[model samples]
Target: MTSATRPYGTRERRRSIGSQGESRGGGEERTGPAASEGQEATAILERARAAVDPELRAAVDSLPRRMRRVARYHFGWEHADGTPAAENAGKAIRPALVLAAATALGGPAARAAAVRAAAAVELVHNFTLLHDDVMDRDTTRRHRATAWTVFGDADAILAGDALQARALGMLAEDPHPAAAAAAARLAACVVELCEGQGTDTALEKRAPAEVTLDEVLVMAEAKTGALIGCACAVGALYAGAAPEDVDALDAFGREAGLAFQLIDDVIGIWGDPGHTGKPAGADLAARKKSLPVAAALASGTPAAGELAELYARPHVPEDPDDLDRTALAVERAGGRAWAQDQAADRMSRAMDELARAIPDPESAGGLLSLAEFVTRRST
Candidate 1:
């Protein structure tokens, strides 16, 4: 990209970020919560969302009427009753990665050309969210009632299936040379994601001590890393990058995605309801074996033993107030710190992979900023 349109300055921006994204106050537009996180990264996400929305909306509009309504409501484009509502669609991070990856390797023209591919990726992501909410029994998403709760499980599920089909169909109709390969990779990602979700569900059913850290991490990579990797690889393909560079971008995205999942699991436990759109300590209440909990269980500390006992309790209606002890146990077992360290390490690996793909710091700044933005999400 030209200097006039570049998201970052000449200096490298891949610095250490903690549980929150570093905010340098770069005259950013402050579009929303996403904007509040970081200047350059949020701007890239906002622009990518803007570019992809029309295509996404058009694709949704093509669905059958009831399905269209569900899609619109889930995407936060309309109320459950079908009236216009404020947009609560997510920050568009995945799609932004697509555009940023393309721009890094090719330029603005590549980014522009990849908009359809970006929208396709976002569709696949939302499809998974819709299904995940149902399986996880999650009531909230994007700070609103999840589709399964608002519309019913059957409707929400059918809508999710439709969305997945729509994603592939969108790509099938595209004339871009890269479109076919992108579709194939995305389809394969869905398979891996399903297996990952399956593993997560199975783990939750077992005794806390029965699950291993490696098992959870593997599931996380499949469930989260696969799609993010596909998004970046798709963008690289659109950019006409060499095969090795495309693979490097895929690796970069997978590492960053694992970090994203680590932070998300952290938020699942300790997040503020106002920001996370879910009740605090919800994961603990559910006794879900998140990465932090898994680490704590494996720590062999006295607190780890306490956490194991807490998790072994049978399922009951959750009282959020009852989780303080459990959360404290996990923290005392060093779960929180371990997850944070692992997240930072994963991001370091991500930066390395990114450097392999785009060696010039100037060309790489956009991707680096985004990787930090994802990992740095704070509760």
Candidate 2:
């Protein structure tokens, strides 16, 4: 379907979806519960991470010594001197989604059943991060030097490859009745993720005018959504849930992942350096064809023309003010507004799919809260 005809494109439909959590009888707002319950859901995520971290560490430790050192350092588990560090690792959102999906469908027992799937997803997630840091020439991640910057580029790439292999190996060796199916699904997701990354790199080589909003959206789905969707599906598969339910959870994760990426792109350009752990207007400085940039260029507004002219220059804008101006131009060209609307629309659709998967909205509290957390600016 065209963007204009999509369920989330129209303001009226957007408003209707926004009110889905309200009390139909008295018009009472459900926002309060959603916020409180989102905290509860976040707590659940922490618990899942606690349960999965040891296994994750063990998986990393199983690699060859050199690879293990690089992986451990990348995971913030060790310092450059090979000593342990107290630094935090990733947010562990993908694995948390897996455990949450399983819990939502089959409770605590299902969480246990899905633990291997959770670990596998987390591994795949970090694998992507390692490769992404190299491809983007990113110097810092988690407020420290990226693996490729500290170690050699080849080692970083090898570590990422090993992680990907380990992820599939974990699933392949799983004793769960659904292991084979889960592994197959995850393998397909990896392929899609690669395709997405390829498309993203190809778009960067093109002039802004040559890209389309649809093309960017498709890339976002492939790059971010595919793995997230796979994470959720893996959980359902471990529980032996019906195929329809598995598909519903997958759809929900895909939508939530898109929303997450939309906001992430915004943060990439305009978020506080202290909070985001990156320079201000990082995306603009890199001339990366993020969603906001694509939307602005496609707007055909005068501001878009100005922004395009700025980007076409040979050197990236080194002056902070110039980068700020470029960011403002993007906003004025309607890119910011478009991306925010798309994130909201995706969140609404995600909730719809969650409802379909779980049937009882109240019973899906953890899933609902997690979904809300993904879309919100503040966690």
Q: Which ranges of candidate 2 are over 4 A from the true structure?
A: 1-38, 314-318
Give a tens-digit lDDT track for model 2, residues 302-372: 99999999889753454647887898899999988788788877877776777677867666767666666
Give all TM-scores, in the order shown: 0.90, 0.90
Residue pair clashes in candidate 1: none
- TM-score for candidate 1, residues paired by index: 0.90
Write down the worst ten-residue block by lDDT for model 2: 1-10
Q: What stretches of model 1 exceed 4 Å from their correct place? A: 1-16, 21-37, 314-321
List lDDT for all candidates, in order. 0.84, 0.81
